[model samples]
Target: MLLLLDTANLEDIKKGIDLYPIEGVTTNPSIIARENTNFLSRICDIKDTIGSGRMLHVQTVGLKADDIVREGVYLNQLMGDNFYVKIPVIPEGIKAMKVLKSMGVATTATAIFTPQQVVMAARAGASYAAPYINRIDNIIGDGVKVVEDISRIISTHNLDIKVLGASFKNTEQIHKACLAGAHTITAPLDLVETLVNHPLTGASVEKFSIEWESVYGKKLTYDF
Candidate 1:
């Protein structure tokens, strides 16, 4: 599954990229608002840092269909082809998705809370549909099931859209999302870091190091 950091903090972004096989970065209005900087310049900085090959998802703040379309177009123009314009699954967003998809621009339908939303967004031509996993679980306790159902529906209908699960609270949620068939996930740095921070894993590594040192006279592998 593809993993993307759902943050706008440059340090977290850099560390995540350097420490993991990060596929890309994703940001919404809330994430961008936290930076409190020039919006365009900040996004441009992210573009340069992540470089051209990775996907950078930027959300549209507009609430109207026309305005959303214009914003999506502008983002594509500003960030290039690798940028996936993120739009909500509201009615206006569906309209904008159709227009943007017609123009061959990548679109990610966000703020999804139900299977119906996923179906509609996929039908509207979203390249990826992002379901808020933790948010839905908080509301109805079936977020992972929703993702699984969406995956089944997409596969049954042969849709090309991918499920990008978001809003995770912990590594367990991410694990469940992937097991439920999400092709990708976007999460904050803390939750992502949990993917590699198991206590048993650390203990096992330390034990292996001690055993190796005992047998090899504490010498490094390069020691002659």
Candidate 2:
């Protein structure tokens, strides 16, 4: 699975990139709202920190098809081909997706919950259909299943749409999405850190450190 960091602040974004094999960066209105950085400047900062060939997803809240297309074009004009314009799966978004897809700009149709939403996004020609796994699990109790069904549907239809499974709460959620064959996952830094620092794993490492201090200055080494 391709792991993405959904962060806005420069420090957090840089830190997330450092900790994981970050394939991309996912940003939304809420994430951007947390910081007062200029939109284009922060995007530049994100790109600079993450280096080249990594995606940067930007969301647009357009009320009409024309407006959505305009904003999507505007956003694309600012970034490289790897950047994906994130549009909602709403009516106007679907309309906008058609235009952008025809223009060859990558589009990520986000805020997806149900399988029907995935179908619509796939038909709309979105490159990525992002489903909020944690948010759906809160309502339906089996959010992972939605991703599985969507994957199957995409395969059956021979659609090029990717399941960018998002809103993960823990490593378990990520595991489920992977098993379901999601194309990518946009996870928060907190969850990513949790995955890296498993409780039992951390405890064992700590215990090893204490024991090592009695013998040598260091006792850990990885050989390949």
Candidate 3:
């Protein structure tokens, strides 16, 4: 599965890139606004840090189809071919996706809460469909199950789109989403770190270190 960092902070992006095999970065308007910097400059900085080869998904702030298309074109021109414009799974967004698709601009359908929305977005030519996992669960819906259903629907319909499971609150939610067949997932750096660490793993490493130090009176293997 492809792992993506869902943030707009350059420091976090750099740290995540240095530590993990992050495929790309995904940013919404809220994330971008949190940085409180020039939008174009910040996006450029992020692209420089991650390089042009990696994918960058940026959401559009347009509410109309024409405006969304214009924004998508502008972002495509700014970020190049590796960029995926993120649009909401609404009527205008679907219309924008169709126009973007005709122009060969990649798109990710965001703000999704249902499998039917995935279908509509995919049919409209979205390269990816993002579902809010924790948000769905917050409303008493089975988020993981929704992802699973989306996967099945994709396979059954042979849709050429991926499920980008998003809005996770914890590692368990991420794990479940992966198991539920999420082709990709975007999460915060802390949650990504949790996936790489565990108390048992740390304890085991410490035990090994103690045994080695006791035997050699040094922590470095090269010292011997």
Largest lDDT belongs to which candidate? 3
Instruction: Look at candidate 2 and give me any clashing residue pairs.
Output: none
Provide the lDDT at 108 for model 3: 99
By TM-score rank, best first, the candidates go 3, 1, 2
lDDT score of residue 170 within candidate 1: 85
What would the per-residue lDDT of candidate 1 be over residues 86-140, giving only the tens digit for each residue? 9999899999999999998889999999888888888888999999999998996
The prediction achieving the highest TM-score against the true structure is 3
Clashes of each: 0, 0, 0
lDDT of 2 by residue, 1-224 (tens): 78899888788778887777888889988888788878778777887777767888889867688998998898888777688989998898898998999998889999998888888887888989999999999996687999999999999988879999899888999999989989899887888777677679989989988888867766556586
Residue 29 in model 1: shift from native, Å?
0.4
Candidate 3, residue 222: the lDDT equals 66
| TM-score of model number 3 | 0.97
For candidate 2, give the lDDT: 0.86
For each candidate, give its TM-score against the true structure: 0.95, 0.90, 0.97
Q: Give candidate 1 regions above 4 Å deviation.
A: 215-224
- Tell me how far the alpha carbon of residue 155 in candidate 1 is from the true structure, in angstroms, after superposition: 0.8
RMSD to truth, every model = 1.4, 2.8, 1.4
